[model samples]
Target chain A: MELFTPDFGLIFWMFLSFAVLFFILWKFAWPAITKMIDQRAELIDKGVEYAQQARQDLDQAQAKAEEVMQEARRQQADILREADRVKTQIIEEARGEARQAAAKELDQAKLQIDQARKEAEQNIRDEVSAFALNIAQKVVRNQMSDTKAQTQLVDSLLDEIEKKN
Target chain B: MKRLTLIALLLISTLVSMSFPAAASTKGEDHGGEEKIDPKEIIFEHLGDRYGWEVPFCHHKSIPLPIIVFGSDGLHIFSSARVEHGKEYVDGGKIFRIAAEGDFKGKIVEIVDGEETRPFDISITKNVFALILTVIVVCLVLLPLRCYYRRKGYKAPRRWLGAVEALTAFIYDGVIKSTLKDKASKFAPYLLTVFYFIFVMNLMGLMVVFPGGANLTGNIAVTLVLAILTFLVTNIFGTKHYWKEIFWPDVPLWLKFPLPIMPIIEIFGVFTKPAALTVRLFANMMGGHMIVIVLTLLIFIFAQMGMAVAGGTAVISTMFSIFMLLIDVLVSFIQAYVFTMLSTIFISLAQENPHKEHGAAEAKH
Candidate 1:
């Protein structure tokens, strides 16, 4: 019963102390602590969110770089193929022109050779007839100088002519 | 760390000074006679309030405090030292003495015509002094932190600030947050103050010597006020649903219709919680101190009985007292934790939405 009995003095003191403490703490201490904790958490969350966005941006940039590289590679292949085609076409045109010029030159040389051979054949014919005519005039002059020889030659000629007639 | 070491040195110096005076007085009194050790006197004196902080083992040397009394004569104030121990003193028209042999024994009272007159004793007692000291220590530990917080709202805490921050965060996260859920931040300051106050007092009580010893939490008046504060806080912030559940509980219709039996029980339940809080804290703390005192008393009891028994008892008593002191340290921490935990739980229960249960059941169906 004595223990249960309240001491008003102690109660008054405890209440006064507690009230002052609670007021000062609530005013200055707790608010600062809680706010700082909350602000720190928010800052950490923001940092993590920013890091995640940066990682995503890095991935997007890498993908764009790969796309550009692939496009460049494809364009390079097309350019190389067009260059190979042009080179082959130029080589073919050069070969075709050389073949046509060689064929024309061969044809002209063949005509000139044909004309030279005909002219030589005519000149040989003429020289050979003139020699034969000289040889016949010499034979006529020898035969007139020698009548008998000439008559013999004439008789032989007449006989060959009569036989022909 | 440095400050704590300084405080430790101060406490040690005070203990040394206290013992020297006590030893000198006891030696002087030894030639007169052997003092008969009364265990009850030791226990009760330790538990009860004092007008002055008694220097351990010393007679006629105590730190007197101010006494404030309210009576038919309005208010009277004086130094408690004015009232001689076990003797009466006449001051102006009133005689003040310490009651020594009755129901009001150990109390400071006003004597009129040889009868003890009951004037309202609203003086600064041992417990009041302790409470004041606790406030000073708390303010000393916390007020300096305002500067650090004022500069940066939320950076890393260091030194004493770090220690206080950890404790505050623990109360916020562990007890208040776990109990109150959403309203934890709203009630954090009150709960944190209560926790630190009780913890400091509990630890101070464990000191058991002048300038440090004051069984503040063990004192029923102190615990009562604390419990009452918890009670007021719970009921004041109680929601409509809380009141509904208490007055018109969701019980069987017959239980409600007959005489509001459940409501009566529920309403009674409200006072019982704080009552339990008051008694539990009071009894545990008081009991711990009593056990330690009694264990030490064994040595004196055996000394009075026989020389051989006293010699053996001193060793056993010292060992048991040491063990009890260790347990007292642990008990102080546990009791503080329990009180704060229960207070938070009570407040949270008062704010609980009673309809949420029925809503959940309906949803499940």
Candidate 2:
């Protein structure tokens, strides 16, 4: 019964003090604490959002770098193929020039050979005709007196002509 | 080796010293005198409110508090020490004494014509001092939380203030926000204050020393006031729909019209919520403290058998009391949480959707 009984003095003081405490807490403390909490939550959310945005930007940069590298490699391959084609064309032109020069040289040598052959043939005919004319004159002068002596002289002249030729 | 021997000797001496309260009985019996110690008085004395603060291990030494009361003759103010030992104080030919028993037991009463009558006592009692101490502690803890938010803004506070922040967020988010939703912000201060107030009082009552053991929350008077505060918050801020639901509930006509049984039950339920709140907190804390005191009383009970038996029982009793005190700490937090949760639920019930009115009216058509 004593435990169940509530003293009026206690009730009076409790009511008074509790009411005062409630007023102070409601007016002063609560607003600031709750505001700070909400602010912190907002700040955290913003931080997470910014991090995600940064990661996305980094991914985009990486992809762009990969694309640039692929383009550069394609350009490099084009330049190498162009260089290879130019080298083959230059080599083909040089081979054609060399073949034309060799053909011209061969044709000039053939013309020189033909001229030398004609000149040699002309010199041979002149020498043979000169030797024939000289032998004929000697035979005619020596063999004027006797027929047997003229025949002998003519045969000797003929033998001399054969040796000279 | 020498230190080990010394340590063992110290342990034996401490255990022997711990058994002295039980050993005192035999010493009394050997002198051919039986000292009868009343366990009920010890338990109730510890639980009851006092005019003076009791000093530990000293029956006579106490801190006197101011006693203020209004008698039939007008207001009277004096020190409670004047009436400490059943002594009568005469002021202006009016005598006052602290009554020992009867209807006005443990109250400051005025003697007139040999009949004891209680004055209107507004004196600061032990429970009141504990209440003031609790209030001061709550302020000390809560004021810093507000300052941390004010000075540092959104950053978390360190140490004990950090614990306070977490507890506040827990009750705000877990209990109030979950139940009351948008109105959580409006009632946060009152609900949060009550939460800290009850928790501090419950924890302080668990302590066995001064400024700690006044049993403030365990006192029926204190819990009654707290419940009344919650009751006032619920009804005072109740929405129109809440009253409509109570008076003209959406049930069948026969229940509310002819019998009015539903309305009666609804009105009865409004009072019972606070009643349940009051009894639940008071009984849990009071029972915890009583159990610890009973376990300590076992030492005196077992002392009647023998000194060795009392020593053994004292060890067992101390162990159990420690265990009980540890469990009471958990119960303290749980009771505080439950009280705040129930208060939040009741407040939300009052703040039930204003949109319900349109739906109910439409349903009638």
Candidate 3:
């Protein structure tokens, strides 16, 4: 078999087809394809923007959670402080009442003691005057009776008075 | 009266020149004084008797061009068609010799040796001229259409641009971008050129009945060269991945345990892929052309038998030829697409990075 060969005629035709096709396609088809690609790219950009928005929303949610946790912490501290203040006030009120009751009881006891002391003094003085008068009457009635026995009684009575003083 | 006399003398000379056979100069041999052979017989003997075939061949009678001969002496350049007395007539205006012969001009030199020469003269052939004219027609018609739109102050209708645009979009979306992944646009111009080149050539081949005698695409050499170019471009523009896949394929250790053998086989597979592309395109074009030629030959063969038999066979063969012709038209477009598609596939394969797949698999491992 003779080896097939391409001639000038074939080459010319090939070149002609190439040139014409390239020119026509470049003018007509390329723009549409490029446009389609651009549209696709725009869609991808939109998708990316949406993804970014979602990410931002997530971050905002995280920050809000953090703020709520901080507020809870502050509220907890306030409750703890109020509880501490209330506890101190209750303790102070109890102490103030205890002091007032103790003072009132002391005042009543002093009044009672003063009254008893006065009573006792009066009783002692009256008893002492009666005894003295009785003694004088008795002396005038029985002037010459037993001088030695009277002297012995007076000495025992002196010893009792010294112990009482 | 003077002027009228000169006009009459000029007309008479023109008539006389038309009647007389023009003297032709002989190139290789000199027949000084032998009975002249008829110009028609010489042409018939050279083209028909020698080649075992005859085609209706004609050219502008004004220009006498040299006859091209492929013989044992390689391509023997003759001055012109043999007229009479072993003399040839070459046209002055049309004939011009180029240094290039066949396709490979610079690389492979044509070796000529003295041997028994079977001199056969195949004329320019109407089909060859028609093929050339088709290219011219395409350029003449489409170039102006392109320019009319491109020219300042001229706005072509949307439909006109739309038609051209559709083809461009098809090439870009269908062929180039689909083929060359990263640099589709980079090679879009080339791919587009190739697509349209094959498309137009195939289209011209389809229109052979109009002016051209045979389908130019049917020539195996044309398809082969195109396949070779695709092969070269695919390999030349191949990526690192392309080579890596072939040289060091990703396979199980057990499968590749034969060490050097597996690598060699893989490398061979890479070469065969492009080779298959070459063979496929050449085979398809050649097969299509051969079928058409055979169909046409049947007409001639039947006519050789008896007239009645010839008439009946002619009808059947012509019908079949027409059917084949329609299919051949479809085949032209299909072959062009197949060639382009295979070219794209080969290039895509070449540009693929085997390492990427290997890395992904390794990550899983």
Candidate 4:
């Protein structure tokens, strides 16, 4: 019976103490713990988001650098191609000028040679004509003494003319 | 490392076991003979409330507590030693004794006109003292967290405080938050407090020495009060739909008008949930205490046969008691966790949302 009977005083204390404990915990203890937990969770989430954002930004920057490098390489290739074209154009122009200069020099030499050859030919012709005239004068004085010698000279001259024709 | 910890745990429980014999011996000396080792009386004495604490390993010595009682005349305050060993102590011309026989046995009863009358007694019995100590301990352990959080501001707590946080979070995340969902924060304080409170008291009961061995959680009155509080919290915070479903369930209309069976069952269910909570915790702790007491009493019981049997039984009984104590510690944590888990589930049941039905339907596809 004693064990079966509920002790009222102890029950009162139990209720009182538990109520006080609950009130203390509800009003004081738990808010901070739960709040800090929430704050820590929130901070972790923010950190993860920041990391992902940074990774994305890094990827974008890397992609931009890759694009820039590609652009630079293309520009370098274009510059090299332009230089090769310019070098070929300059070589062609130099070859053309050298050929023109060589052609002009050859043309001047041919003209000078032609003029010298004409002057030499003219001198030879003048000398030959002068010698023939001197010979004709001498022959006329000697051949008048004899008619027979003059006819033979005329016939030989005609035969020479026929052979030249 | 694991094996080492187990060894160390067994060693510690052995130390706790040492006090069990000492306590039973002290009780054995009261009967003045080894043959009078009544297991029921010894176990009940250990499990039940007392006016004074039994000093460990000491005979005829108990730490007296303040005995405050409201008798027929008025209120009176005195030390428990005044009524020690069933001695009558006259206070304010009224005779009072720790009643040995009659209806109010093991309780302080007043002898008035040669009649035993129960007083409005609120003396700080062993259980009440232990309960107060538990409250203080809980307060001391938990109250500082508020300030610690205030100072730390989202940073992790230090050392043991971090361990404390882990335990709280386990219940919060594992039990309350999972069941309550978005409403977790609203109910976490009460639930968390209860978990820690019950856990601490359960652990305190395992030790047989001073400041322990109170058997507070095992007491029906205490568990009853705890259940009552849970009952109040559940119904008070119950949602509109919860009450509506209880009063007018979605069962057929004929069931409501003719029988009102659903509502009757629902109302009974509201009380049964807390009732089960009370019995579950009380019985588990009580049974655990009883088993260890019985196991230890085997030493004294077998001693009547012979020294050889007593020695062998002592060795075996000590080992089993140690094992049982270890199991009891685990059970202590489990019972606290279970109580909190059940309470959270119950509150969540009461907190059921009207929109969840649609969500449940949508989830199937």
True contacts kept of each: 0.73, 0.69, 0.14, 0.80
lDDT of each: 0.80, 0.86, 0.55, 0.85
Q: Residue by residue across B1-365, what tens digits does model 3's lDDT show?
A: 99996676556534433322222222112456434445433322221111011233221121223345554444545433233222323333222222132442211122334122223434343334444565565455445444444452223225754565456556667876765656776566556556656666666655544444344455554555566667777888978776766666676766566666667887786667656765666566556655655654454444435455555555555556667777877876677777777777666666666545754344324
**How high is each candidate's TM-score?**
0.76, 0.79, 0.49, 0.81
DockQ of the two-chain complex in candidate 2: 0.50
Clashes of each: 0, 0, 6, 0
- Score chain B of each candidate by TM-score: 0.86, 0.91, 0.61, 0.90
Encode model 2's per-residue lDDT on B1-365: one tens digit a residue: 99996677556644853756646665566568877778898889888888999997666778899888888788888888998979999876789999999998888999988999988999998988888888888888788899878788767898998988888888888998887778888998889999989999999999899879888888999999999999999999998889988998878999999899999998998999999999999999999999999988888877777777777777777767878999999999999999999999888888876675674445335
In model 4, residue pairs whose N, Cα or C atoms come closer than 3 Å (at least 3 residues apart or on different chains), thus clashing, are none
Tens digit per residue, CA lDDT, model 3, A67-148: 9999999999999999999999999999999999999999999999999999988988888888888987898568637787
Candidate 1, B97-188: lDDT as tens digits:
87887877777788777788778887887788888888888777777676777886667778878888777677777888877777988787
Provide the fnat value for model 2, as a fraction from 0 to 1: 0.69
Model 1, residue B164: C-alpha shift (Å): 2.2
Off by over 4 Å in 4: A1-4, A56-64, A90-165, B1-35, B357-365
DockQ scores of all models, one per candidate: 0.45, 0.50, 0.06, 0.49
Sort all candidates by TM-score, best to worst.
4, 2, 1, 3
Give candidate 4's TM-score: 0.81
Q: Which candidate is the best by TM-score?
A: 4
lDDT of 4 by residue, B279-312 (tens): 9999999999999999888877876666566666
| After superposition, candidate 2 runs with Cα above 4 Å error | A79-165, B1-17, B22-33, B354-365
